[model samples]
Target: MANQKLKRWLKVAGQLIIAVLAIRFVVKEIDLNELKTTLLSANFWWLILALAAFLASKFLSAFRLNFFFRALGLKLNDWFNLKLYLLGMLYNQFLPGGIGGDGYKVYLLNKWYGTPLKQLIGATLLDRVSGVVALGFLACGLAIFGHTATALGAFSFILWLGLIFAFPAYYLLVHLLFKRFKSVSHTTNLQALGVQGLQVISAFLILKSLGVENANIDYLTLFLITSVAATLPISLPGGIGVRELVMVKGAGYLLIDQTSATALATLFFIISLFSALGGLPFLRLSQPKD
Candidate 1:
């Protein structure tokens, strides 16, 4: 156990180091002043729209978990899912390891709701898988159709194909888990989440356009794909450079500039903030005992 923890720490440290190197390169090309100006200049309405979109995503996440739990014959409410997910988001942002967010998730539900350990662990895994499929579907769409995907297109397509094929097997997976590890169960409900982003043809374009323009179709798809991928157990702090790395690699497969891909990767973080923040309401509801 100690050795495993050490490895996880070492892996996380490596990711942070890589992220720092990437940020250094991104800093050289990204005009901080221009980026700031673009961010500040975003129409108030657009920000509102973005927040609305974020909330929609959060709600879908919670809703999906509820459906999945019910399918497994576990009784849970949307309110419970919302509160638990929100609390998980906050912990993931602040705490350092697996012992952080969802670890707290298992602790909370097992203690408060008195849910079986297997149900809590299994449900979280299912939630993550659904998120992956949704994200992959979006990325694949972008790679095939978006102009900039010249570099990342094939990567996205491959990922999309994988997710498409895997969707059917999710339920199968849960059954297998039940057979092998009867205590743990996986859920496969995605509720209704949407991915919407615009795009530009090139890095020069992403930098020149109003920063918030629809990500190029491919990039937009990549954003969703990466978003889903970020939820994986193997990830960087808040998925920092990992998102960029995936986008750049996938985008590169299609012809997207590394610099622009990096920039959009940053944008994905900004979007998740709203999604995370939407949980604030649920957080209020989740206040642990005084």
Candidate 2:
């Protein structure tokens, strides 16, 4: 446990350093004046409206999670579920490892719901699998039209389609494998898995609406791939530079300016920070309430 905690902090430290460096590049590369002009020119109302959509997505996720827990006969309150979900995002956004937030969620599930720590972790892991698969599909689609030679060369096209198409196969295989493990929840809510896919898809839409343009098809493949990769195990200290770097790298890969990527990444982080604030109240309540 101590080792795990140390590792988490170390990852956080590394990301913070990287993020700070990335932020510097963003500031220097993008003309703050013009960036402001562009930002101001856009309709601010979409961002406002998107907030509602964000909340709705969260609600849907909570509802799906509720379905799973209730089916398993676990009793929980909506407030608790919402707060926990928010808190878990806090961990994901700020913690060092990709699973950091989910690990915290497992702890809370055990604490509040008295679930076996392992199984709670398992359930969360399963949800992540669904999300990763969803993102992979999008990335694959993005790759096909981008014209950039995939690292795989001539067979890259075939490989990309295989990967994009394999997400389903992977899920099916895992579902079957889990079924054999009697300890895993046989009553798994597959619907919840679908919800995970929708959530990522929605986020992509949100990014597009914000003016993140990827070439080829309408969306940015490099952006999706980089963002998903950065969100992996190295997100520490608000995902610090990791998210920004991914954005910069993604945008750069797609011929967007580094400054623009940096600004967008910073804006996205700010939004995430605000959303993460929902967890602050629960952090205060992290201590068991008698």
Candidate 3:
């Protein structure tokens, strides 16, 4: 017990260190006064719209996960599933361990529904994998387009090749994950696209809120790239510092202001936190019965 506690503490410490380093880097690299000025001038209505779009994406994500649950013969009702999902999101953002959210999910579902551990774990893993795959597809599309418009070299050719093979590769992956529910693959893929599309729209709204007008494609593309980076588990507490770093650096490639990009990422993170807080009321309650 003591050893386990020590490990947990160590994990928390490590996450804190990483978060601090990431934040410090962003602070050092960007002008804080500029970031503050930009944020202070943002359109609150636009930010609200961005938050709404982000929440809609989470709802779609909840439905997508429940689809897998139905396949596992544990058809949790939509409301209950969403509540559970929000709780999981809370853990994902705030917990110390990399897989805290997913592990909590497996534990809850198994205890509440007598779900088999292997099947529950598989469903959760697949749900995560599906999102990552969608992100990969989006990033590759953006990269290919951006490179083609700006350059005509080997790097662009490689990106083109990646785009060409992305579909077939993704198709094979879908088949592997959905052999039993083959008929549902199309619907699931559509849901994934919707989720990602809304998120991209949310980013666009953030850019607009920050007064970015003409160079939206560049900013949006950079946002997508940072979105991909944020998916990695290296960042702590809602990917706080890591995301800001990615956005600030990515903005340089597009010649967008670093402070503005950081502000955008920071606002997105705040919106995410608010959404995650929706689960707080249910955090200590037992899982709802269907």
Best candidate, lDDT-wise? 3
Per-candidate Cα lDDT values, in order, are 0.57, 0.58, 0.78
- In candidate 2, stretches whose alpha carbon ends up further than 4 angstroms from where it belongs are 1-5, 24-33, 40-42, 67-79, 94-100, 142-159, 162-164, 172-177, 180-219, 257-260, 281-290
TM-scores for candidates 1 onward, in order: 0.73, 0.73, 0.89
Model 3 agreement with the true structure over 46-150: per-residue lDDT tens digits? 999999999999999999988878877888889888888888888886776557777998998898889888888877776766676676677667766563236
Please provide, for model 2 over 2-81, each residue's C-alpha lDDT reduced to its tens digit, 9 standing for 90 to 100. 99879867876776677688767666656778767655554456555545555565566665555445544566677777
How many residue-pair clashes does candidate 1 contain?
Answer: 19
- Name the runs in model 1 displaced over 4 angstroms: 1-8, 28-34, 97-99, 148-160, 178-215, 232-234, 247-263, 274-290
lDDT ranking, best first: 3, 2, 1
lDDT of 1 by residue, 1-290 (tens): 99998997897777678667755655665556665655555455544555555556666566666665565566666676778777677767655433376777777767776778887777676666555655555456555666544554455456456547755565476566644322333333324224222211222133333353443565565566666656555665567656766776666565545555566566446655545665556554553543
Candidate 1's TM-score: 0.73
